[model samples]
Target: MSDDAQTPTPMPTPNDCDLPRRRSDFATFAEAIDYAARSEKGLNFHDMRGTLERVYPYSEMRADAMKAARQFAAMGIAKGDRVALVAETGAEFAALFCGCIYAGAWPVPLPLPTGFGGKEGYIEQLSVQLDSSDPKILIYPAEIAEMAGAAAERQGCEGQSWEDFSERPDPETDLPEADPQDICYLQYSSGSTRFPTGVAVTHEALLHNLYGHASGVNLGENDRVVSWLPWYHDMGLVGCFLSPIANQASVDYIRTEHFARRPLAWLDLISRNQGNTLSYSPTFGYDICARRISSQSNVAERLDLSRWRTAGNGADMIRPDVMQNFVNAFAGAGFRASAFTPSYGLAEATLAVTVMPPGEGIRVELVEEERLSGRPRDLSRPARYRAIVNCGRPLPGMEVEIRGEDDNPRGDHQIGKVWCRGKSVMHSYFRNEEATDDCLVANADGEVWLDTGDMGYMADGYLFIVGRAKDMIIINGKNHWPQDIEWAVEQLPGFNHGDIAAFSVETDNGEEAPAVLVHCRVSEPEERIKLRNQIADKVRGVTGMNCVVELVPPRSLPRTSSGKLSRAKAKKLYLSGEIQPLDLAA
Candidate 1:
């Protein structure tokens, strides 16, 4: 065994000694009110104006939540009743969520889904999801109330717009008390590829995870996060919103749509607000910064970011160049490389699996590609291409193991399945028992590990993620499959047969750039040129990336022994330049 493998790392656990538990102490969401009440600054909601609008002082938010709780109780929402929320981020979403907790109901937060191919496509996808979960009540914005009401009617459930729901008087009823084990919220996965799975989180689980994260990351009342991540995503919901609330901190939010339209607005918001701690979009946002940072005269000089710490990099591949570009661009603004925290997490793990400890700085390990691909190779020799950026170590209370095909632990630098188990692992996938059992597993020792379905290894104490065990392509923060893109391209003429294989090739651009590769089979030289240009255009239309299309001869494409288009194998071949590339006119 190597020295690296022999090293034992300490796990993160709640400082129960510093803050021991008490039975009378609040364990569940019902107790969250008391928790907020104990805080000095009180609960605040910062609106788009950057004004500190007090929605509820700790006492007020609690009172409103209690009022809403009474109304929910009168409406016959019992404990465990799943309530879906489809509103944007605001005091309403927060209050509704807390109200659900006070009423002992489960709040299911759904991002206002839009931007599909068309309205019909959006409605279809929304209908499919509604059928899957089958929540009893749907709360949405007044503008989309009719749509939600119609959808709920179709699903045989009750639906009310936030306008009407908030109008009901506070009922004179006793709110149900909740235990620590009671479910708090159902956080649905982004569903970038397939149907979103609702991850059930208990009150104890959420509180423990939030407390662990806030303290471990050094977030406190003094910290302020400038966020554009959608409130529906785990990072935005749990990390930015809930974590800040738990710590009595403040956050400034930019609507995801507004940020998308003007990425520069995100930086401007941060600058204007003097946000001290925050997150980011991937290289795409870095590209936006590279474009605007130079044009905006003395912007960094104007913005005070010296207090800004813990700028987490995740929700997509972490591109080293992007981080470097961001740091270099804003170095004048007081952004430190030490503040860049490249983390590993998933919705299933309640948004955090492992966080690089603050102030450790970012670390990358360049390993031999052959060794990483499961073949034995010289470990000491510097490889032509290597994986970069070790994503620090796992969080406390979490155990990570790299196992080979036989489920035995693999040595350092050997790529295998990344498995983890801890208090943060979600309870189960709502309504999908088989998937819940398959992904969430218990070993003989009785520790339940969630199969991350990602392939990587640990070096020293840091965890490095390589690729997905599943054929999922993550662009930006969204996951897509080559098939999803391929299906979109097959709609174009001259590209119908097993003519194309779409896969992501790792780039030196750090982790953010998952270069999209389209291998299309074309016959004649002229046809190949035309087909390459045509395919790139089609893919860009669908995926919003300048897709690199390489035209090759029919049957030249690599495949598995079973004749399946192996994306992993194709990516390997592309990196090695084994496949022929038909020249296209530039």
Candidate 2:
């Protein structure tokens, strides 16, 4: 294991970064990089200790990518062939991704374990993706080469290091011509082992989203992106890496593992950068940063977030309290609440679906609980409300709709399944026609729409997500969003995200009832019972149903590759008797 396992190494920006403006005018990623090659500033890499590991300019990156393209051609890899890459936030991976584009092959960015899962776990996960992608070539960093090799061997695919992939000469023939409809890459949605749905995005769809994203955020001449998001994810790959190239702007990079150890390094990079900064993170990311720096004093003096024009929150439900905590903790350093840009998106739409316009900050709307659940408010009972923050309007080319069960659009404040239609929407789930037909629907006017599988409402054209529709618990015909239950239990003392998984469990009597799996740190029998009872009470109060709370050991719940708690996996594990409850008597 590397020392980065213990201590954080901060990645600093290079001196050569000239901070360019949005010079976007391209049809495909290959064209975008070819244009970027003319610029001095491009992708850069930094170590965990704030050191500039590599300053790979766009020109050099393009050259390196071409060399990789030659290697692919030499190996008889045809255009449109799948090439699996274990995405490591480095210049090498960036170049390889571009190389796939220039070579006319579809690059599949797979996740590299960052200590969340052990070696065997990572290999298991990698092998699944390898089989799904069915790539002829596999390239990974030296750090995880053994695991990568194991996965490759299992899949009967050839593997090599990034160095080996790029060390060869240029191909004899000219690079293949790329069309706007050519596939840029494959992004696997959550659930690798159980259900790997690889979304196939085209150059036209991706570029359209990038243009809409720039216009959606009102991107300016001086705006620059600073990110530590894993490239395997859409936000990290499309939003940070490809968008910067298409827009001709320079971006700073750091490994996600480094950011995990020292989240403050994220803000530090933002604070130190002189250009207008744009960054994004999930809700827990902000929560973790605030709590990590709580014990330190003079944070204001040490940090300079005044230039952070847009701090985006997405990839999960935006937590208002966590956002407020971040603002309160950093207000002394000139961080404003208005800097927050709450947005809603998923990989199926190729990243940006909706974005908060510049200067809107966040607007929390308190809708009646009944109205939220598609029921009229009962004047006879005290009306309850849920605080949902506005996720702004759809991007320029994207359309967001709140559709009810009948597949018709719902009115304002009526919660329903969220659907989207746009130029950026993916063509289909690669090689899975049945899954594609299930979600991708065509309208009467011949427009294709994507079923986001998310439950949310619309107010004044803004979207407010409640939770996943599949995760919603139904008891006695009324809809109970598991997010509400999990959130209510989160309000309990010492509880946090991933500590609880709420789902509907079938009873022996053939009735579906809400059940909660909570991680209990307290080993004392009495305290465990007390905690479980308290959780059940809180859940019952919010969900209007009695919940069976099962206490398990801490860190027992399953999480997705991106580190989001996987309720589906947890439910499967619990039902299979895999997650044994902590020994305790009733």
Candidate 3:
């Protein structure tokens, strides 16, 4: 046979039916990995074009992790020490993260440089996180050595590429013993409206959340996962990475950057999977994929989505219209509407708070504008409503509550701050006692409840998120969600999601009013003026007040590391005159 014919076909690890599944029941993550290593399933890394490049079985990963643990011990990486690692979607990161747990060290997964930010911006971002995490050493892929090294040096931490670190002598050494209550890892909050804070999660909390997540999703023998979510985020780390090791399931992964470049390649990977697939993304992921296909394209000929059992939506607000557009775009290709699974969660909760039950799809309720705004209905005005998606019930060991400003529990259909109490909730914000106390409160029974700073209501036991509590704009004692204003502007011709940011600003008269910053693509001076007037009118129609409107250059709005608009940062930059708005006259 010729060389091409002689080469073997690449295959991913098998999801064996003979092996019994465990829902992260182990006391420690190290133990979980130890047990999972007995199985053949693990992570499969893919290229940008949806082609499998490496098949890393659990058995091999465990072996690599053991070596990494020995190396860490030789380097004096003791128990409870934080070791920061840039979360690249590959086998090296997987091995290093597991090795940290095996060595009894707490792994801190940091974000890679985002597309919008230059090297200096990324270094600054990394430096901030490094200062907060205070890791003993920073390990990253060699590609970003210069940038990562600069950040590490600025933070006064040791920095080395994983490639070089792996070459060090790793004599067999005894790893430190771990307890169920020992700190497992530090997850940075991915909030779009606030600075990232490291949330400390214990082994007990991590396992509890993972077990609840597996049960909530009804993880089965035949189910496989395909994903492109960044590992720095909780949903990708705890849900896709760590959960798979504990639950003994195989996965296929494409880098988040790769998915951004060619989003449909994610679906192409799902189509190639023979078994039932579980994939997830934020609402924008689906929106982008749908937008990539033209009305004239035959999706049925290019894709087969009938085997996709769970299409999870989380890590951002779930948009029902976006979900509908996806269904409309791919329904002919056997994509079932029932595959849409909406969920609610945060990093402070260790990951999942509520997961929609399998096969329910997206369920929405028509919440009136008055109810959402917490204002009396204006009877003279025609009733307007917003469709809020049901984010599903709490996990098995999780408890959900809606609390008002008085800290008293609210009844169903009353909007309030959403609170959850569970073993899965994060132990504390790392070394930030004041910030931790601000969110975690103790009740009469001495049970600590997490004050999830999200505004939502429960209806018939289903949670419906309204908006962020901090992002609420109160003008003249009336509450208005920034989403309402942004959505209103989006309805105007030629705008897209995340194209507008709305926040409260102090007016010239010393009164608080809503200000909108829009990303304008029109360059003509006259058209820019017209567009500004159009946006101002749209905002007035929605908020019932004249507001400040500024049209900015395209791609000027700040985004969080996870690619969500950072409204708080945008406001700060705009107020500081850093994010200059376009001069319509010029």
Candidate 4:
């Protein structure tokens, strides 16, 4: 018999009822990890079938991290040096990330190669980010050594596989201490593909946001996390991974790819857990699960979600229709509508600007299309409304304001640009002074504020998001949100969320018009033309004008690293002739 066969199956880390939990109140993240190591709670890795594979205790993780820190010191890693790491969901990545903190180097978490972007595309993305970060070394999993190495070489930076890097000498060396104001890490925004900018977060800012979010959720006894979110994204890395450690909570994690294959396995893991569960995802994750279960039977018999106390929704616009569908599909499985916690945040804010308080599900306000478009109501036309989801109030110590075009604060229920001010806001876009100056504005009082680039409004202290300011389609001085057009087309038969990309394009007549690119599945030419015309009419009704509608093949629309639809990239690709529309019968 093989030694592997004889070895006993590993057990997961305990919930650590004996240890007193801290809400990331520590001075630095290194200190947070150190305190967490004293407890039994740690991270647990799961397979695609929701089976536990490896048990990583915090004590063991800290020990490994120290060794990694020593190895880094031996390699002449200096304070504030950039160590680029491909954010993989595992203990190795977690340990190395902490080790960089211990060594006083800023750990930069980059994305792994996604399914949509081929090898060369991933390599190019990595190379661009590496050039922006100017890292001393790039470390990634051995499985993608060839691609990672190529990217690192292209940018003239040292690259080593995690396995190879770990095998190096770990000589005794003193690690540097971290300060609250010192740069902790660099996080590249998920949508930062064409032009990348690294957002530098300090140790203080990270801990502040973590503590605020933990307090906002009222993290207490029996509260644990179950997540399949990719660590490369801000929500996954800060809210799930780092926050769990600082708060001293055990976590169950499934790889994002695994969850993509079997989303129900996420619920399976939650069902098996005895404690109160907290899981978060974008609207699409819930949409995918609800759609996948439609063709199956006996869902309630197989899954249980009664213990899911916090079902967080963030990283994208919260869709009320999608949320209702999820509730309809899983309410029988003990999923409560009240557990849905919608939040609003960005990478620049270090993860969360505001998180819905517990017990408040998806709250929304019905705003007239005229108000949303920044135009007066036209009495001749019937009123059209859009449901804007309330994304909760600001976190403790965070301030939110909606500003008009004059850069003055707008009143309640007035749609304008969203701005946030807090200690949790990022220090700057690393090495990009021009970009930093463009977004981070200072008042006469010398208080700095972050322009979130999102358009929203305030009502009774709650925030209701309209859409992205950059995504607003302006035609003949009338502002129209692409979401409005996309959601209108989705109302038509045979369409899904993320199936359409809408933007403004200039026509041959020197007039700007709305252009809708839809993912069409029908192969017949006549049906394609019908679908195209149907979509065009739907868009026309929304915008009150004729628009360009093209049917593209399915699965061609570009998505950000975190799986959010990238309309900017879609428009660029369509204009560059990279995204070809299918031919229809004349």
Candidate models: Cα lDDT each: 0.66, 0.83, 0.90, 0.91
Best candidate, lDDT:
4
| Segments in model 1 whose C-alpha atoms lie over 4 Å from true places | 1-26, 40-56, 191-194, 272-276, 280-287, 375-383, 472-501, 504-586
lDDT of 3 by residue, 248-332 (tens): 9899999999998999999999999888898988888999999897554779999999999999998777889889999999998
Which tens-of-lDDT digit does each residue in 241-272 have in candidate 2?
99888887778888998988888888887887
For model 1, residues 248-342, the per-residue Cα lDDT tens digits are: 55456666666656666666555654435555443345545655676767856666556667777766555565577677778888778888787
**Candidate 1 vs candidate 4, lDDT winner:** 4
Clashing pairs in 1: 11-396, 12-396, 12-397, 56-61, 276-308, 318-511, 319-511, 319-512, 320-510, 364-389
Q: Write the per-residue lDDT of candidate 4 for residues 1-586, one digit (tens) a residue.
A: 8766766767777765687888999999999999999988899999999888999989999999999999889999999999999999998999999999999999999999986668998999999999999999999999999999999999999999988999989999878889999999999887531247999999999999999999989998778899999998999999899999999999999999999999989989989888999899999999989998988779889989999999999988899999999999999999999999999998999999998999999998888999998988889889999999989989999999999999999999888899999999999999989999988999999999999899999999998888888888999999898999999999988888899999999999999999999999899988888888888888878888999998998988999877899999999999999899988963
Off by over 4 Å in 4: 1-7, 192-195
Per-candidate TM equals: 0.75, 0.93, 0.98, 0.98
Which 10-residue window in model 1 sums to the lowest lDDT? 10-19
Please report how far candidate 3 places residue 201 from its true position, in Å. 0.6
Error of 4 at 236 (Å): 0.4
Q: Let me know the TM-score candidate 2 reaches against the reference structure.
A: 0.93
